[model samples]
Target chain A: MTATSPTARTGQVASAQPSARPGKRGDRTGAASRAPWLLLAPFLALFILTFVLPIFVAVGSSFTKVTRSGLFGEAGVKSEFAGFSNYAQALADGSFVASIGRMLLFGVVQVPVMIVLCTVLALMLESASAKWPGFFRAAYFLPYGVPGVIATILWSFLYVPGLSPLFDVAALVGLTPDFLGANTVLWSIANIVTWSYTGYNMLIIVAQLKAIPGELYEAAKVDGASTWRVALSIQLPLIRPALVLTTVFSIIGTLQLFAEAQVLKTVAPTIDSQYTPNLSAYTTAFAYNDYNVAAAQAVLIAVAAFVLSFAFLKFTNRKSS
Target chain B: MTATVTPTSTSASPARTSAAGTRRSGSKGRPSTIIVTAVLVVVALYFLIPVYWVVVAATKSTEDLFSTNGFWFAPTVALWDNLAQVLSYDNGIFIRWFLNSVLYAGIGALLATYFAAAGGYALAKYEFRGRNLVFGTILGGVLVPGTATALPLFLLFSQLGLANTYWSVLLPSLVSPFGLFLCRIYSQATVDTSLIEAARLDGAGELRIFHTIGLRVLTPALVTVFLFQLVGIWNNYFLPLVMLSDSGLYPITLGLNNWLSQVDRLPEFYELTTGGVLLSIIPLSIAMVVLQRFWRGGLTEGSVK
Candidate 1:
């Protein structure tokens, strides 16, 4: 299948080499070049229909509102220019503020822990003397392979009070801390996120580690400095780009913390309808059936994500530079 | 962590004197290796224990799950029996949900990977007008969370009369901006410009060059993107939750969520949901094992460049 397609095309093109030596050859070739366009057509059409057009429609619809007249309120409904009313209403909602606060807190707490854990794991895996580092690396990376939903579901079972073995162990120790309670629920979600993602970030850092020409480590070893000193000076500075990449991804993922909370909310009733920013938007859209409000909330979330991430990158870039 | 560091300079000392000296030191190696291996095993067990418990819990009836030991021990020979009950429960709707999940993720990832690869290849190789604009737009797209896009996409899909259909779920999955960004980066790193020019000089068409040479060198990235999109679509709950209304269209995540909601009413659903969760993981685990090599190379290479 692989060899036949390319070789046959090559053979045909090779055999047709000496066909013509006139202006007509250029014309024929130009017509033949259209074949590539034919091949690319399906992908282009799909892309436009699915991606490009939707954004345009969404942007346009965000500005409009549906209204009906009195005494014939149900008879005729028409789209009216609402200006910024929807956006204003969404901003006025209290849950939106709380959800944003929750996400900010999640980012503040989760991103740093994940980054530090990943860095430490990478350092351990990259240390020259560490035995079976590859085995450890793969084992650490195992959780990342599980789909996020499955990971959350699996963790939910573990977090469920009586069902979880962890809970059982806690009960045995006579220190049964409620993992899914209101006080620690956020952190519980954070723990799940940390578990799923720490290894993924570690792999990113390890890749950065591998690319750091071994000579640097060799040079560091030659110095009188200890392993900690070498890592602090050499490895940390070198892997800053990968660190930034993971940080940005972590920020985005933290903002979109729906699956974990949604699954847990079922078992742990303490998780309110609007536990996270995305959940707020989801409930507004689906549960309330308020499409206009939901659209407004969506735009607000996007703007918030954009500003926070953009500012973070700008600040980090400035400080680093 | 602190005690593990040992300076290699002393170990590299050339001598009978060093060998005689370190013969005593070598004896401690056994205890340290044991400690390290033990620590690693503990961590691995930490990773696997929940999954292990879920499997064991799925096998036992409700009575055994609580009555027997927490770990998977004897006294629960109901593995097949529980599986059968799960399959037949609610007129076998669990199986339908499983099939729905496979369709959403399996087909969705395939098409999404295709679009992402092609789009990424174009951005990497071609010099079209507005190239920077397109690329920058995609970069912007990468930063926008999918959850943020869900409402807008739902409204738009509803307007198009495509809501609650397969296309509703599949269409959004196909336009993964992050996957596109990765592919663009991967292609830029992997595909050789000189070879492309050479292929063009040999009178090969552009599409032919892309399929034959471009995708060949891009196998590693393609695999990575496929795995990423696959896992992503499989785990996707928010989109399916928002888009599909019919229970028949629910992916395993959403389906299990729906089941989890009703588990309080019917405790039998507890076993079925756990079993479904276990089954849901099999494809992903197999995918991981099959494609683990690609992940190492893909991620390592993406970072290095």
Candidate 2:
């Protein structure tokens, strides 16, 4: 990459050195040619402060325990190393474990449904004879603008029994729908997730679809291929990168489910404070006054997210290769 | 931006699409096209339904909010009344929250976009030592869940005496690995090295060249990164919820959620919550429609990398 860079390619060798080198991360170069370093400074500083430091702090704090001398801590608080105890405590809480299981189930069902919907939407909108793709695309994407809490608040109206026309119509047909029931609220949250993000994932796929060269489509038509054939044979395989990208994000998102479930908790009895792992860690730290345990739970959640994404990546990459 | 990349491409697609349209209509009958249109329409409705319900529900009075059907307007039109009540309800705190949101999201996304552009341009156009290390770190950042960073960040901010300040939220919103990734891809494909060299030879400094030449060609990337982070920060709840405890510092998301969490006790807030949700979404929904072209143009050009 360095060799192919334009300055290197043009052989704009520095007066004192080759390629001006712009130095390195810590070359302490003269003031003349520090453009790249200047450019990268702001992002690097904040990235380290907010991103790198947090992970280090969370991990470092997770290993230690804090004990107060008395009920009100009249004596000084003592701190000591406590390896793996916080993790054990986090796992021992059945609600915390249940939260992880719930998120896994949500992802297993919702992520695939959302990804498939996005792919289908992308393909259909980009199809040869598709009409009004622009209008339809905007309609699908408008929900992405609505914040998660707001989206749930709007959807909760439809989930409430007496307020919902959906339930009213169901009852008229000699049936009753319990959207906020303990067993059904999870799927209702699933419905909200699908509504909120399909457009976003679809947009990415659409962008990828647009990048597909017109020559391929023309050749498929030259071969007298049908629309379905072109979609299956060419479009599906071609958009795999976008599909994989959306799926990985969707999985991470499924793990970090907080605001939507929190908003739905107002109407649904099923949604507890620890209904999702992200919410669980939040409750642990703020409500239970257990920062170390919360940090451990957070690390576990991050591990779950990484594992899920890597597993999905391996599955997709292996299949393609 | 997406109307036609160069207008010449437009001539080819319609001809091809119409040809395909007629052939499919002939073989599979008109039902095929109708089916496609029907399915597209249904999906569009599914996405639009929630927004439409909000718009309708916002117009009714608090009493009508419950007695009326969830999907339609009730007998009385209380749109203005609801707005007045929500606006004046708590000494007009909602407006303060709205402005706070604008401050956090608008300024944060703009600075973040510029940083991404500059950082991305550096990564793409220059080769420095540890470049791979920087890029590799950012790649790992992409895989890390953003929320996990929030709690620890709050702890650190409090330690630094920066908690409850706007900087806590604004500072973190400024670094987006994904935006930097997109800008890098866009810059690599679009920025002309020959132009940069020529400008340099003419005695234009690096920053001047970047501003004049590099950023000119990087509009698609700038627009994409700006809007992406704008939506992200604007809709963000967890970070602000953790960082700021002051009501005055609350963004619309937090303020609205605060009201929502109280609706069970004060059922009258139902109207306020509905009105607030509708009002909050309007600005971005309009932007979504108006900027749809730039989004298409930006993402279409640079998504591969």
Candidate 3:
């Protein structure tokens, strides 16, 4: 990656010699090498200011603890260099640990369902001999266009028993389950997620499917293969990269699940305040004003997310490479 | 670009064989194909029904919303009334949130896309020191969850006296590492380097070459990145939840969330919240319709080339 350059690729494609071939390469070497760096400077500047610097601050803050006790009858706010105090407290807190476990459980159930639904839809769309795959693709992707907040609200209406026609139909069929009851709220959230994201992930898989050379399918047909076999053997394998990409995204999104769950709390009061790790962190920082502890909790959640993502990447990359 | 001119090998072979098979296959199973098409249409309708409900529901008054057939035609007209109430409520703050969302999504996506295009173009088109290192760092940024970043960003912004302001939301929205990665990949595909070098050789400065040649070549990818960022920023609520205190600065997302919370106390808010949901979706739908061709074209771009 480092050795390849636009100049070299251009030269190769054009079959042209560098203006001064091997001998005078030094004439162009110094200035030519600096151009990419100069172009990258502004991005790097913003990255440091907004991303890298804030991360360092978080790490540093995560190691400290706050206490208030003695003063000249004053509000004695103090920060101490208490190594791992915040982390220990965060890990030990029942709610924090419970939220992490809950989110992992949520992701475990939701991500697979989402991936399967998305893949099936993508396959169905790609396989259609119909005249309107374009229109159907857009229709499937429409929910992805709806903002999460808006989608959650829309789903809530459908979930409310009396208001939703779907629910009314269910009632007529002798299934009178509440959508946002204590027993079913998580699935309700998962439903909203699958609805919003199926199209988004389907687009990725469909794009990957479209990338597969038509020659492979023709060759498969010549070998007496069926539509299902073509899909199972060639199309699935070819789109594995995009599947892995969508899986990683789903994991991250499932972990950060907030909007739908938060909105559902309106209808379902039984949803505990800290039902997910992100919600817990938000409550800690904004509602509780425990910045240090919140920072520590955030770092832990982030590390967990990083570990899962990196493990996925490493496994996939090793196999692919 | 040259690849398009290179005789398409894959399609030529398939088209020859599939052409004959299609005619035979169509004669044998036309009915099943129709059934399949019907099934697909049903699935599509199932997916789109809620949106239709919202539109129709938005048009009905509170009484008619429940009294009318839930799935289809409304019994009354209340769209303008609901919209007027939504706008005039809380002193027209919903409009403010709409504007804030536009600013946050529009400006933030524009800047984010520019950074992504520039950084991605540079990475794609140049050989430089520590390039992999820089890219690896950006990839690392993509993996870290946004929820984790929110608390830390809040702390940092508080330290800088920037919390609870527009910048808190705006600044974070500009840092889309995935968009940068996609842009880099897309730029690598679309932009030919000889055109760039020829321009440079013709005495164009780096910025001028970038603006005149590189930017034009990068259009498709930039639009993709921009659309991604726009959807992202529009859906972004956790950041504002952590950053903003004043309801006056709320995006429609946060505003709707506030409305949602009060629905239990006031059932009237259910209608307003639903109406707000319907209203909120219009911008994104419009965006999709206008940009549909661009998005589809962009998605298929890298796959073939």
Which predicted model would earn the best lDDT? 2
| Structural similarity to truth (TM-score) of each candidate | 0.86, 0.91, 0.89
| TM-score, structure 2 vs. true | 0.91
If candidate 1 were superposed on the true structure by all CA atoms, what would the RMSD be? 7.5
Candidate 2: where is the Cα deviation over 4 Å? A1-33, A72-74, B1-29
Which sequence of candidate numbers ranks them by TM-score, best first? 2, 3, 1
**What tens-digit string does per-residue lDDT give for candidate 3 at B92-139?**
888899999999999999999898888888898888779999999988
Residues forming the 10-long window of minimal summed lDDT in candidate 1 chain A:
A16-25
Pick by lDDT: 2 or 3, better one? 2
lDDT values, one for every candidate = 0.73, 0.84, 0.78
Q: Score the docking of each candidate (DockQ).
A: 0.29, 0.40, 0.34
Model 2 lDDT tens row, A1-321? 333345544665555355445433123223224888888899999999999999999998788898989788788888789999999999999999999999888898888878877787777677645577789999989989989988998899888876666776677789887888888889889999888998998999998888888788888778877666677788888888888899999999999999999889888878899999999999999998889999999999999999989998999888877
lDDT tens digits by residue: candidate 3, A1-321: 234455554554555566336324443555567777877777788787777887887888889887877654267778889899889988888988988888888889888877876776677567634447788888878888888878888888888766788767666879887878887888888878887887888887887887788788778778877555676789888999889989998888877888887877777776877888878877887788788888888888888887887788899899977
